[model samples]
Target chain A: MSEFLIASLAICGTFAIYHIALWVHRTWNHSLTAPVLVATTLVIVVLITFRIPYETYMVGGKWINELLGPAVVALAYPLYRYKDTLKKVAAPIVAGTLLGGIIGISTGLLLAQWAGFEATIVYSLTPKSVTTPVAMAVTESIGGVMPLAAIFVMIAGIGGVLMHHYVFRLFQVDHYLGRGVGMGSASHAIGTATSMEVNQLEGAVSTISMVMSALVVSIIAPSLVQLMM
Target chain B: MEKVGKMIMHIGLLYIIFQFGNWIQRTLHLFIPGSVIGMIVLFLLLSTKLVRVSWIEEGANYIVANLAFFFIPVTVGIIEYYDLFLGKGSLLILIVLVSTMLVMGGSGFFSQWLMRRKEWKHE
Candidate 1:
């Protein structure tokens, strides 16, 4: 097959599966039906079953990835909408996120080191808490493997969404802002989407936290790595 | 026709802002991602009334709402590293899950604590 034909099929197949997963999520209201997770699983299954090369599937996948850059840029809309609320609580949000970013990177690095993982694995784990693009960039700057960093980031995002409700209930955290900030700082985009399901306001706050977490981590991660070394 | 026109215009504006951001990042050698700089540019444009929020609100909301869909392809690309993950996948999963919970708990607790303290001071 021509690359054009294969790429088109890959894109169409991904969109079709993703919309189906969205429909399933709406009908069943199940968290596991998160469109990204479902689409990823289905795509992997098809590729493996058909013995298609990952590179072939990526012919179209890269196009979709390109769109992600703009989608992330779109996040500024919510940040703009919620500017008033964010200003009101700006001090606490900044302080909390700064603390969260520091604690997250340190613990991951320390744990990986104590566990005796290789340096590359430890480097990859350093940026696992932020969104994939920023995380991958920070990983590279800090001498980590890019793909491993991406996988670690995806795992963090998915795990944060899955554990958020239980964590909140256990901690008796009833504050919406707190919930949104906590999830966003820890899980990034997926957690923000999950927050949106419960409340628009929570989702808006999450966008801020996610963006702020990325900014802060990118600024400080290199310095922290130097400090560690 | 009007809504469609507005949507196209808004998306075009966003792309321009993103391009500008990329330019800035490259010139300054900033470590931050270009899209994030684009976000700040959009925020500033809207806040300063240089661009009306309503102009882009519909398109931006549509994109943000479907944000996960945009990430699907890049995520599926993870399959390219299937071999690298096989040996250490379980360990990675454990570490990710544990650290995620810790970050969530730490941030949530801190924010909640500060909010309560502020409320107490006011009352």
Candidate 2:
């Protein structure tokens, strides 16, 4: 088959699979069946079984991936929707996210170094707390493996979303401010989505926290790596 | 026709801002990502009332709603490292998972404490 045909197939096939996965998520309504998790796994399984290479899949996949940047830019909209609360309660939000972003980076850096992974892997782990698109760009700027950074962000986001309830309960995080910052800083987009599902205030605040974490990490991750290295 | 036009205009404007951000980052040799800068620029525009929410709300909502879908193409590359991951991947995953929990607890506790402190002050 021609590359164009193959690429078109890959693109169309992905959209179909992702929609089906989204259906499964709606039906099951569980974190384990989350759309990103299920769709990614399903696609990987199909590719491995079909003997299609990752590069070929990406011929068209890159077009979809390129939208990630604009999607990130779109985050500003939701954040802006909560501008009043942001101005009214900016102190806790900023403080909480600053601590979370720095602490998350520090602990991940130390853990990765202690694990004795390569330097590239360590760098990738530095920006893993932010959303994938922002994390990917930060990974490149900091001389890390970009893909690995994305994987780390996904893992952190999913894991944080899954564990957030227990974490909040145990920490006595009864307020929306606490819940929002926690999920947003640690989990990024996925966690923010989950928070939004549960509470509108939490969701709105999570959006701010997520954006702030991205901005904070992009600025400090490189320096933190340098200091620790 | 108007809705379609507004949607197209929204995307085009966003892309231009994103590119403009990239240009600034490139010329000034800044480390921050252009997309992030664009996001801030948009937020500032909205806050300043230079851009109305009605104008760009739809496209922004669609993109943010399905943010995960956009990254699947690149993230699927994790499969290529199947061998390496299969070897000791579980351990790496565990470390990140645990740290994620720690982050949640730490941030939640800190923010909650601050909020409570503020409440106490008011009382």
Candidate 3:
């Protein structure tokens, strides 16, 4: 197939899969239908079945990826809108994310190592709490594989999205800020999306937590890894 | 045409903020990413009444709503590392699942505790 045709197929296919996933999520309120997971799986299946290279798929996907920066920047709106709530809970939010980042990285590193995984995989696992972009950078700087970091980040995200509600309920954590910070600190964008589904204030708080966790993890991860070694 | 123009203007403003963030990073040698810096800048702009929410609200909401689409490519890039994951994928998944749960639990409980403490102090 031609590049034009492939690009069209890639874009159209992703759109279709994401819509279906969104429908499923809305209908059943299941986090398992996260659009990113479903769309990624469908896109990969299509690429493999057709023998299209990943690079080729990205020809169309890159357009969507470019928007990620803006989308992240756009988080400021909700953050701004919810600034009063943020101010009220600022102390706990900061403390929660800071400690959460440390706990997440340390626990992931220890487990990966205890499992006897390679150093590279262990390093990749270190930044699993943050979003992909920051996780990838941390992985590379810490001498891990970047792509593996993305995978770990996704796994962490999906895991958080799928389980956070239950985890919060289990602990009787009904506070919006607590729930938001918990999900965002551990799961990043996916968790933020899940929190958004619950409430707007929760979503905004999650965005703040996600950004703060990214900064904290990136700064502390390298030194923590050195200390562990 | 007008909507397109507005969207462009919104994104352009974001780009300008991003540039300011980049400059700050370069000047101070901060480890923070430009987009994050831009987010903070925009937040301050909104807080101080320098920028109205309506100016970028539509574009921002539209972009944030469809944010998942933007990550599909990066997630699919995981195929490039299939071998690394293939052998230990289960273990990695287990670690991710367990640690994520622990992190969520820890954060939730910690924050809840702090909130309760504040409430008690007030009482």
Candidate 4:
């Protein structure tokens, strides 16, 4: 079979497995997003390990990733629809975002350093809380590896999913708006997805946070890297 | 004739807003992108009651909701680097998995804590 066809089959097959898992675990009410993303990527990675080229995976996965832009554009509708509430929280949103951005980058760098990660890895880790495109660009500008940035982005997403609830509880962040913004800013898309489950207000704030975080990190990270170096 | 002129003016305003956003980013050395600055501008205008959100809602929504589509070209670039990912595939996988969990958990916790602090201040 053609490589594209094989990759398509692989992606589809992986999704099938993910859905089946969700079905089996439906009674438990667990999330299927993380599992699906991790499983699909894992399956593809395993295939690559056996000499199935990444080009083949890209042939299929490319289509999936391509949808990221339009999905982002779609966020405008909700933002507009909820402008009233958004307006009320505008100051806090921006403030929270700036603080979150600073804390996220600083904490990651410190922890990575404390763990004895190499300098290159430490630079790559700085943008983990940001979205992929911004993080990738920041990574490249600072001489960090692009693929490593991608890995970091994915890790950030998974982390957002697994620990958001516990964190929310621990911090006593009961307000839906604050919770959503925190999640979206910190975890990007994955956190936004989790926010959606909480409430529409949370979802909207999360979307805002995600987009803002991307823009903030992209512009800020490069300069921060230069200064730190 | 006047209404048509007004409509033209509104379009011009949006163009200026976008440019202004870009200019601010370039001039002020802000860490955020121009488009985002433009977004903040728009948000501010709406909040101050200077401009109605309805005026830009349609366009803004279109961009935000479908933001994911823009990443396609970038991801397609992944095909070019297939070899690199393959060469260190396992290590990459491990890093991605571990770091993602850490970022998600850490950030979530930190933000939540900040939120609580904010709440406490209010009380």
| Model 1 misplaced stretches (Cα beyond 4 Å) | A222-229, B1-5, B120-123
The DockQ ranking, best first, is 1, 3, 2, 4
Give a tens-digit lDDT track for model 1, residues A111-139: 78777889988998899989887899899
Report lDDT (CA) for all predictions.
Answer: 0.81, 0.81, 0.82, 0.60
Model 3 over residues B1-123: C-alpha lDDT tens digits?
999889888877776777787788788876667777778989999989899887888777766676677677877887887775566577888898899998888987788789889989999
Query: Could you tell me the lDDT of residue A203 within candidate 4?
Result: 76
TM-score for chain A in each prediction: 0.87, 0.78, 0.88, 0.81
Better of 2 and 3 by TM-score: 3
Clashes of each: 0, 0, 0, 39
Q: Over 4 Å off in model 2, which ranges?
A: A113-124, A131-151, A161-166, A169-175, A193-204, A218-229, B1-5, B116-123
What local lDDT score does residue B24 receive in model 3, on the 0 to 100 scale?
85
TM-score of each: 0.90, 0.84, 0.88, 0.63
- Candidates sorted on TM-score, descending: 1, 3, 2, 4
DockQ of all models, two decimals each: 0.66, 0.58, 0.63, 0.14
Per-residue CA lDDT of model 2 for A1-229, tens digit only, reads 8989988998899888878977997899875676667778888999999999999899889878766667667778877887786677788888999999898989998998899988898888888788776798888988898878888887888678667777888878888889999989999877776666555567778878888898898888889888998
What local lDDT score does residue B28 receive in model 3, on the 0 to 100 scale? 88
Candidate 4's docking class is incorrect
Per-residue error at A118 for model 2, in Å? 5.9
Q: B45-120 in candidate 1: lDDT tens per residue? A: 8889998988788888777777778777766766776675567667767877888888888887788788888878
Please give the TM-score for the first chain of candidate 4: 0.81
Candidate 3 residue pairs that clash: none
**Candidate 4 chain A weakest ten by summed lDDT:** A66-75
Candidate 4 residue lDDT tens string, A124-202: 8778777675787778777787777776676566556666666666555667666777778777866775565455577
The sequence of per-residue lDDT tens digits that candidate 3 reaches over residues A1-229 is 7878877877887888778777876777665666666767877888899898999888888877766666677878888878886899889889999989989989988999999989998998899999877898899999999877888888888778778768888878888878988989999987876676566688888888899899899999999999996
